[model samples]
Target: MSRRVVRQSKFRHVFGQAAKADQTYEDIRVSKVTWDSSFCAVNPKFLAIIVEAGGGGAFIVLPLIKTGRVDKNYPLVTGHTAPVLDIDWCPHNDNVIASASDDTTVMVWQIPDYTPVRNITEPVITLEGHSKRVGILSWHPTARNVLLSAGGDNVIIIWNVGTGEVLLSLDEMHPDVIHSVCWNSNGSLLATTCKDKTLRIIDPRKSQVVAERARPHEGARPLRAVFTADGKLLSTGFSRMILLRRLKELALASPPGDAESLGVVCCDCMPTAQGNNFEEPVALQEMDTSNGVLLPFYDPDSSIVYLCGKGDSSIRYFEITDEPPFVHYLNTFSSKEPQRGMGFMPKRGLDVSKCEIARFYKLHERKCEPIVMTVPRKSDLFQDDLYPDTPGPEPALEADEWIAGQDAEPVLISLKDGYVPPKHRELRVTKRNILDVRPPSSGPRRSQSASDAPLSQQHTLETLLEEMKALRERVQAQEERITALENMLCELVDGTD
Candidate 1:
């Protein structure tokens, strides 16, 4: 089931070098950063936005063209009433960026100008549905204007960005806060992870749950579940282990004639646990082994799956042995920090030799720095046309068609033909960045620089500054919300008073 095939950067250091095992350095300041796909509309140019965590509403839009001389102010995207929590670029539109925030709304902006072309602030759009804070927003992998957002209200709302309407609302499905939502490459399947220790797959069109895994992990706070390069599901949770399986496998495993049976496969994999110890009586000997939480990732070229253990900080690589039906562990990479979100470059024929490390950095603070690992672009697993193309996949073809039909000026692709090495210029990182935090149980003590404050401290400052600039708007929103709640409270008071 697995075959070997392959593949596949530079840097500037604003932070002084620390000279540790990994050439560790410190001092650069990055509030947030994300790894870009090699086919990223910007290509080779690592794209991400960084915010000043201390209270500034301004954000630095980075078009990291060259690692040696990264231009920080390429485009300063502004206009958020509060500190922005999440920022993502359109997979096919480099000039478009969407952000979710503590401002209780989501806004889509045209990059560079930071102009808000679309804003969801109406009572129904902002407050009527989600009673809690919105934590994340995810654009469909191949859909032009489709998006999915999960919030503190324990709901997932799929939105049609073009129409600015909620397509479907997934509520009462997850027992706890939903942390993340993602669409598979084909767009027919949507996966969600929740603090309820479950991962559910949904058919967004029908607004029904097709597949569900109960207690997918031992811990709550399921961080995220993502699709791999090969079109499998990887769920990561608080137990520090990622659950890996095939969507096809999951569907097939459902009851016959079940709605989930859409050519889905059935399978699963577990990370090997080391260090044998005393076994307690009455414990299932073979099954009671430590079920390390695995954050699954796929390497398309090698057709291998990497299981990152959040509990152990080690990556175990596996590959489907017989397609069964069988998956085999290949190799492993050990590191210090636990990885959060991970994905391979989406492109064909990428050179693997260029890949250096196992992960990338986002929102780093101390003088920004590129992740030591140079991830290779993920190649195509199956033929492009082989996938379920109901809603269509890949925007390139549609753009091409539009270009031919319309007399519009010649459209330029985000990436031109040529190989560009990954570079880092003006890279920023912070010692106390959230991504840099290692839980107390992770062992080593982390050192903090003067500006590297805890998230709580930064949150306090951000909240105060945000209240100052948008106090009127926020108070209005709160007053409306409180009025409704107060009416309910008054009714209760009258009933008891």
Candidate 2:
């Protein structure tokens, strides 16, 4: 007879508490886009959410400190001609953010430290390479100004935002639409899941698939994948089981169960050192039968993985360990309303004094609420175990260095003294001027060069000119309206006199 041993984890007793009514952001009209995006993005300084705009795409950015009812006419970050699908904050710069829209373009904006009095209608630079709606955006984990965008065209374009140029375009990797894309700890490799029912580990610099597994899940539903702290792949899909694959071997390891189960399955890849071959996935856990897609957010500092379903009312988190039960269920944060989308705060953004292990901005139909997960502590001093040295705002590598095959871990910062967000840093784009290029000194070549500008470049220039003209006209109309209102007020004052 053997006794069953129970696993112990500090996060086992962690409980989630919603912020006070005054602390939560409210009265915001969340976007109604049915796209499979989080629709919200956050950093230590600001909270951004895709919102409903009349004629075009727009998202609202709010100062994290200034929480309460948002004014109906609050300024927005608007420039996309179509509905914005996804938004991601740059890990290295708190003031910088990237947005993807259905207009087949990506725009990066630099938000100011103080709230703006008017809408930020212009982007620092516009990247127009995707031929279809761009739905997913992810910034390089360790590189500054290196952003990745996946579009409906089934192409992934990694851009150097600082120079307004495409660094790498992985156009031929996935045969179908890419459902999800994640960077490893060092940003050297990418873990992506595509609609083709396959999971791939791609080395974007080499433009090659290092390892891949076909049909990790048999269901046709969307799949999501993220790299763990140990560099293993953890993927979840509608096939009612999560499949974990070892990157070295591309073998699947999942919990023992019927792969035909009718629910979302969560699996963690077991690390292995062996030959490259496909192995059956072993499932670690079976989730609820809800149709909502589970979005897994991994915290490398804490070794904790939070699973947030799109339309679910609760957030379930797990602790990944090296023991038998590789993934341990911690607890679920339940609420009354299902979250339409969620914004996860970086570990550095959490309040270390409050013993906050994780923080989430849960999006509702008409409001955005803050949910804090804390581990109770007996002492008031800083808990070293709970708060480890986490990735800070400073980047470890530049865009060019990363593109040139250099990899470095994120620079870590201690939370002992708490973290202070740096002052606003503007992202500058150094676009190449077409006129700067000198044509061949030879006669025939010089004449040909005058009319040989790339069609795409010409189209982009024309688009920018049209947008500037429209904006000028809009400003002029507003000025006239203001003058008319001032005259009317003056007349009323004279009549009263």
Candidate 3:
């Protein structure tokens, strides 16, 4: 028997334009994943929309603003010999962009500090490896210059943008065409949903997937998959065992429970496969999918993964937890206007001061609308209550290092403060100078930017006291860790003697 559900989501939608006018395109490919940006890379100054270029063999970048139409003088990146399938903005550099093409090549292009032209003829780097059309591309969440791409040949490759090299290629895992591939929070493990109806969790360093769940979904549909904030587990505390395992156990990783029972959902829309006696899939009544890829994006800091479908006009999000029914259904955000595509702004680009944790730019027939999701708070005041704790540590691999064959430190969320938006002046991407790859000096905590935030709030005694208290606690915690390590060392020494 399937269980019926009624969920009330906390998210509220507010639609506004990312540009000044209603931006329109000719047969915009919102039906497929295009990887266009809703906001600019450097300063959030412009919104990027992908359009079918000229006839059909290429894609053009349409830049818009809240003030005017696309600047004709602004250069359009045009190099693909075949139709461009998707594009991704570099997470670390606002000046950099990447596009995947049906010509079986991926091109990396750099935007000048100032350029005036309708199109650019060359790319900074061209990564050509796929035997068939390259269709998907994604940048690493934390690391710079690393990229992942999947193609029609049923293969995936991790690329190094700094040197333009193929760092790793995964070809033998999926029996059929690849549907979607996702990098967990820190880029340690990659989860792939494939036409074979299997979900594979990979240890990137080994070049082989150590675990997999067959037919995690019952429907014969292209689905999306992701690792929750905690590795492998879709939600925190979703299962008691998942929460209790040690970090090392998660590395070579023993799964917390039977893959069928813990990972697959027993949904009414999903039917059990031909010969498996797994636990029943969860009943997810909100999803209305007839076809196309259902891509999922997980925000580790917020513990939310939004699932968006290409054919469907609705987006359903779920909250991950440590507690079965580990993936709790949050409400679905629907619209009468179906989207051709969608773009999610990064955490740094969000307006957390207003308790805004997430922003999605949905492409309609005529305009790109910004949908803001926030936690409800009574005070207009900075709600530390709603934000994520401080960001976890950086990846162990440095820039230019190949992600393949190295064990990555799991991406974690350490609590201290939450998503604080970039300042308005800083956000004036159009009016600002390009940022250097690395600031001359950076620290654990950047003294907040000289934003328009009130000086009274900056100099408040309570603020100072709070800062000191947090610093002291961090120091004391470090000392305790050291003491424990020293004792372990001493015990080892005595045993040796």
Candidate 4:
């Protein structure tokens, strides 16, 4: 007689619980833009969501503490001339956010701590290089002020937001639209999926595709890929399958078999020096047959990966291990209403005292709900096993250092005493003038014309002028206060005399 073996895992009993109704953000006008990008983004200090606007694109930024019904006329960060496709909060700075839009530009905004009375109509810096609408934005994992954007024109541009300059542009890699892009732990390599059914590992600094696997999934639908904690590639496609491959192996060997299997395929990209190749058999799991795409959010602390399907009312999480079944199913968090989009909070933002392992912001039709996942424990003491040193807001490397081929892991911070967000920090952008560079010896210098200035430059000038006017008003108010104080002092002295 054969006895069945049970899997022993700490996260096996983990459960997800939704916050109370009063804790949810209500009456939000979620955008109806028909795009694959997640409409919501959240950090420890604020929650941002793309909303429908009349003339152009806009997104509302609400303090995390403001939980009740949002005012319909709540001020928005509006500047994009078209619908905002994606927004990503900078990992190194909570107050900094980058947004991609249909206007073929990427704008970085500096969010203030206090809520603004009027809509913010200007961005700290606008990056314009893509010839088509930008659909994806991802910040460097360990570098400061470094951002990456993928556009519809089949181009990927790495930008240094500190100086508003293009660090590198990988325009020759993808022949079709890029579906998704993710950075590794050190931000030295990038894993991207494209519409041409290809998975590529790119080194932006080298401007080359180090490795690529064509048709990782034999489906017409788009594919999404991300870097695992161990520097492996985990990809999901519409063919109801997930593929895990080691990056080292991918760089050494070529994929041998066709990806026609309809289950989890673990390809051994790394082969031995003796030229021996071993392939793991496919493991199958029955998933929902809905057309909704699966968005996988991975937590490196717990080694848990949550799969949130668009337009689905359930979130399924799995634990990854080195055992036979690498991906083990934990449990599903179900709700009545389907989620339009989802925002995942970083590990540092979780409450360690409550044993909170992960938190998600689920976007509904008109509201946003918070779902907390915790590991039940009998003791109230800090669970060291549940909480590990996670990536904090401090950057490990600067943009220039990263561009110079330096790689560093993210700065880790302990959450044993609970994490406190830092005070509001400003993101300053210093733009370089093109006119400062002299003309080539073969070409004559031409007179600069105001009409020849780029729209972004003109906007920057207007923003500077506005700043000057505001400063003048502040000075005038100070002068008036001083004069009034002097008059009051003189009257008091006369009375005393």
Candidate 5:
């Protein structure tokens, strides 16, 4: 119940730390095994493997082909004594990646050589705060060198990556294991969903709870809560329940009595609205139940939440609206025919790209599985020239030249009116002939002029070169995206608990 304010110095430091996380990929490789779901990483030119369950971590690194195939032998990311639980690339440094493991430690590694840069042994700053196993770790979205870690002890800790310092520890709140911790867009608020069937909000800097509600999924299953793009409340929980719900402001239980405003009734003698006359109360209402869980991938581009059911392998997508209704069933890719631990590789249209899920990649019993989908790309769905009333490019434009030629001349014939204006007739004749005349010939056509021939050929060559340049750029972008998706798919395969 105690509320604390964050110091201004801490706020300035955290906010000023915002910068783009830089990732560079050079001399990196992907591991073999198309069907195996192993945790992976990529930044255009390189690929890194944190853990590969395939062949007992034997095929940890493979060379990624532009064709999306993995060729050649790759070594396991050495050093972790146990299976890595999660791996995250440093936002600004592609050379660095952070991983949490069952070994009760988090290690940050530099790619290529796969050397441990920071062991975080016993946690560089032991969140002695959490008495149980540390299960999850997430870096601040915009802040440089800031990380958030959650553990089995139902505690959350905020850390400074550069200094290896514990900035804040959040404990004594969640009743059960804290499944996840996410910061809002501005990093002012922290949203956590726990096994207690409640989603709680905290002001991270102050380490104090701003709001607490027991209205999340009721099954005691681990849940996830994330803020929407605008930092408004949007939470996913149980009972076919994904609630973008809000709490209502309550009316004060007791009416205040100002003695100055009271004419006759004495402050102590009036049948006062105090003590037993009133009771403190708090209530929450269930707005609506949204389906699916294991959290979801929030697509900021479309404002849609992609959710997969824990009970079944069904993937349901819902638009996060005023009440968040299920928009469509984004194709379901099932393993076990329909149940449990179904992982998803989140991207709107990645299933067809190189490294995309096709008939080629193989799937094993324990490895990660890939889900294929084809969604319209955001760029393709909208264009600057489009308006609601503007129809698509007019088909009639194709025959416009022919139509204009046929109607070019206006015939001026005699009008048998009682009164005919000579000037009017002349004006009509002049306008008609003006449009009917052929365009004046400037000179001999360029093809007939020999000296101009080289200029024409030069122009043609330049046009061809420009076209080729554009094509190369497009191909390169697609290749990079495919590499990124492959890495993401690998993580889905190997990092699952």
Candidate 6:
């Protein structure tokens, strides 16, 4: 018998550490619709993934420079008492991360610098209002300290993390649970998808639904949506499979403009897949038999929308233009290992000089691998073939510069020298001792005698007992685990008869 070889992707350099190492996340487990974003968006520098950690919630933040099991220096954000369903990296500050859990609370955490054991046991601030599990969180794209969270209570709460206050709460906005929320480029408007099978665009200033699109899909499947760079809404849901329940095509439901332009077109398989049985006819690497959800990440700087599917091993890219049909199919990158989750690095975080345009981190049963998407240039020289007349990223407003009652023009990255390659970070694994994260405290410092700070400086009995208790519990757990493994081995040996 012969095995078929997986074809190499011409446009992508998929890289990761070998799975033989103890790199797979030991605490995470496979989950469902989760509504939790697989990747947190502090792109280009850091990526965070939420996992089912024991009876509570925890997230692992990965540095873009390393792959395989995360290094000891990376911060593992934890503290919730239930599974973390969603996480969002603060757009205004890279060090800040916000997480939501089934525990009905949202926490804001600040990541510490490279230290072997930087565990976040307490959050800087906690927002508690929802009576149900908080499954969604989205950071304000243009403003600082602003966050949006939705829960099963069918409410949208805007939190000001700087003051630990709830700026606005549409306590009874939707009739059903909110599935997703998205901010427009300028941050003046927000769009939400709900279990009631509707998409509503809300003007936060007025706290009213300025426009809405009902029944986006013909069938009743869970829906996810995001705003395009030009302010149009793109949503994903399942198709009308009366029998098997197939996935739906990426749909651009509303017109590409302000709330006033939405009354024209209601969504479906969009222009590319229109009149073609409503199935997304992409060049997919794998045909998934199970129903999957398409999570989209859009890059305003490049005008590319990357669609990552749940329970599948492929990523499909499409281009959005100003012309009719708006969406253009690019290509699909596929692999043999199925991804339980995935994250994308932003353009500013990419190594543009090396002809690199995009990067994706894929999580498997045991490991997280990076897939680098490029435009395929021959040499490191400036080639227009790989460099389309691409526009730089346009910030609706600067981090510290947002004016009330004003919308600013978009900003751009330097088109001439924006993507010079050598400085871009290449993802690779660095081999070091597991204990290499910290240096011995041997720097210039005054030494103190044991009697100088007797009771205050020394470890107290209470502290020692607490540490011993923790160690004892850990040893007991390990012993039980070893016994279970031995019994399993014996069962396998006896079965050989």
lDDT for each candidate structure: 0.44, 0.83, 0.57, 0.82, 0.42, 0.64
Find the 10 residues in a row with the least total lDDT in model 4: 246-255
Write down the TM-score for model 2.
0.84
Provide TM-scores for the models: 0.52, 0.84, 0.65, 0.83, 0.48, 0.69
lDDT of 5 by residue, 1-497 (tens): 98896422111211101111121112223223221112343322233454344322221332222223233333355444445555554443434556655455555544443322222232222223345545577766545556677776677877665545566777777878776777765456777777776667787766677776664434433556666554444454433323653221111111122121211112122222223111221111222233324445564434445555444444444443221111222333344433223223222112222222111111223232334333323353332221112111111211122212211111122111211111110000011222235567688776657656656776787799789969977976796688689989999989894
Candidate 3: residue 343 lDDT (0-100): 77
| lDDT (Cα, tens digit) per residue for candidate 6, span 380-450 | 77644444443233335532344244554434444345643222221111223333354466565465663
Writing each residue's lDDT as its tens digit, candidate 3 over 352-409 gives 6566766677776544566667676667665544554534323346544445344454
Residue-level lDDT for 326 in candidate 2: 63
Off by over 4 Å in 1: 1-28, 32-46, 54-59, 66-75, 113-129, 221-223, 228-232, 238-302, 306-316, 320-325, 334-344, 348-359, 362-497
Error of 1 at 236 (Å): 3.2
Q: Which is the winner by lDDT between candidate 4 and candidate 6?
A: 4
State the lDDT of candidate 4 residue by residue for 228-323, as single tens digits.
686656666655234532111111112223222223334431222321121222332345556676787888878887888889899988886544
Candidate 1 vs candidate 5: which has greater TM-score?
A: 1
Q: What are the RMSD figures for all models against the true structure?
A: 21.2, 6.8, 22.0, 8.5, 26.8, 14.1
Indicate which candidate wins on TM-score. 2
Candidate topping lDDT: 2
Q: What tens digits encode model 2's per-residue C-alpha lDDT throughout 156-204?
A: 9999988888999999999999999999899998889998988888899
Clashes of 5: 16
Ranking by lDDT: 2, 4, 6, 3, 1, 5
Query: If ranked by TM-score, best first, what sequence of candidates would result?
Result: 2, 4, 6, 3, 1, 5
Badly placed stretches (over 4 Å) of model 2 are 1-3, 240-278, 443-497
- Give candidate 6 regions above 4 Å deviation: 1-36, 39-42, 70-75, 116-118, 243-245, 256-290, 379-406, 409-497
